[model samples]
Target: SAWLGALAYGIMKLFGPITGLFVMRFNNRAALMLGCFLCSVSTLVSSFIVSMEVLYVTYSVMYGIGASLVINCVMVLANSYFDKHLGFATGLVCSGSSIGALVLAPLSHFIIQTFGWRMAFRFFSATFVCVGFLNCCVKPIKRKRKGDYEQDKNNTIENEMSFEAKVSKRPSLFRNRAFILWVIGTAFGMFGYLVPFVHLVSYGVTNGIPVSKCTYFVMVLSGATTIGRLVSGRIVQKGYLNSLHFIQLCMIVIGVLFMILPTITSFAGLLPFIAFLGLVDGCYVVLLPMVTCSLVDYNDAILAWGMLAGTCSLSVTIGPPAAGALFDIYGNYNIAFHAAGAPVICGALILFFIPW
Candidate 1:
């Protein structure tokens, strides 16, 4: 499952630049609607796939295209609507994933137990129909015409875009020192960040924990993630710290957490630690784009976002397989986890060099 998820993300990187360009050039709401529909229809179609390779083609490739579109569109739209409170808005919106995890994780698990995995997929398919409908509510801010001096919401958007347009003309993102460092640092930072979530349940089960208890570890993580995102968003919006601080701190924290995961043998001992991991992960995801936006011109933020997406996609693709191969060799998650964590530590150290 982890490898397939990574593969799907890797496939999306093929479309990442296109998705970013589309969101930047066209109406993001329209792009999001199209993406939502693609996601829904593809998921509905996936219910009948029998072969694993076919599932990869349909579920991974098709769904990943839609997901890449939706991901970039959402980020662009979030910045458009709430530039003044970007951190808060992005965090709140992104928390939808955590909310889904909190609700759907247990629900899907229950449905799979009661009915089957197919039914669980069908159940999610129905919810996505509504997801497509609600996505229509997003309204992309437009470029304002001259003499539009009325004190209105659209005027606020125009004011923000006008400032961004000025900033965008100053320099190219490719030449920005901050952007280059952030991309390189984050690519390496991801090396260890996902190990626990990918292997947590199986690790717990191997250590004599009940299957249900192990599953709830993910639930606990989701709940903590919601809280972390809310808090981090608020903090960023308030100008408490720059996004780099959060990313660097999370890389260091998550690296340490990965090293400790293999040492934990009891369920009780893992909860506080996993909760911290979730919190760090929540901040990391929310801050990743926020940091990119900070590093580059706002007018070209979509391109920066695209680059970051590709970096992340490549890292996740290689990281899990690397960890898995190490596990195959060592016959345990310990050495694999330690190896995974080393790059994150290195990434954290690299972040200190960012000019921002």
Candidate 2:
């Protein structure tokens, strides 16, 4: 199950670049409708599946691709709507995932226990259709024309020409020093990013905490994550720190937390660490697209984000399993947690080499 989950995540992330290209070729509304359609159909089909192999097609590939499209489109739309408070906007928007986990996990669990997995999936499919309808309410922000008609016409022409030039030089994202550094650094950071999420509960249970009580750890983490997203976005929006520097700081903090994670065994002792980790993790996610936008022209920001997501897919895919494997070898999670911290810190330091 763990390996299958990881595979699904990898497939989702691996399609990031394709999702970006799809959005580029079509309007946001069209991309979003396609995503919704795929998600709805995939979930509906998954509800009827009797074989695990078939699940890989319906749940992993189809659902993953749909999710990638939806996520990438949301990021692009968030970037489009706000310039000054991009961090805040993104944080607020991205917090939905944490909120959803906190709210839906228990609901889904209840439904599965009471009804069945199939019914739960059917409910999900129906909810997605509702989401698709809600998305229809989103309209592109129209810029109000101002000044003389001739001035507006000339400005429009210049803007179109500039956009064309940027599109023609799409390969420049690779040649960009900052972009390259950002992608590499982020990829390394991702190596340990999912470790805690996947293992923290099990670690607690294995180290004397009751399984029932340990579940609250996830709730605490999710709640803290929501606050972290909002706070981090506001901080960046206020110009208190550079987005790139802020992300580096968050990565370093998360690495340090991971290193400290294994030393504490008590529930009380672990609470603060879990909360802090959620906070910093939220900050890191909220700042990712903001930093990417800062690194490239607005026209190319989506592509850069796509490339980063695709490049980081490998590390994200292997991170949790690698941690699990280490635990298996050592018969303890101490070394596993420590090992996870190293790559993240190294990645944080690597980002410093990027020229300001």
How does candidate 2 score on lDDT? Answer: 0.84
lDDT of 2 by residue, 64-109 (tens): 8888888877875788777677778899998998999999989999
Task: Give the Cα error of residue 335 in candidate 1, in Å.
Answer: 1.2
Clashing pairs in 2: none
True-structure Cα RMSD, model 2: 3.1
Candidate 1: 10-residue stretch with minimal lDDT: 142-151
**What lDDT does candidate 2 reach at residue 280?**
88
Deviation in Å, model 2, residue 231 alpha carbon: 0.6
Each model's C-alpha lDDT?
A: 0.78, 0.84
Q: Which whole-number lDDT from 0 to 100 does residue 320 have in model 1?
A: 73
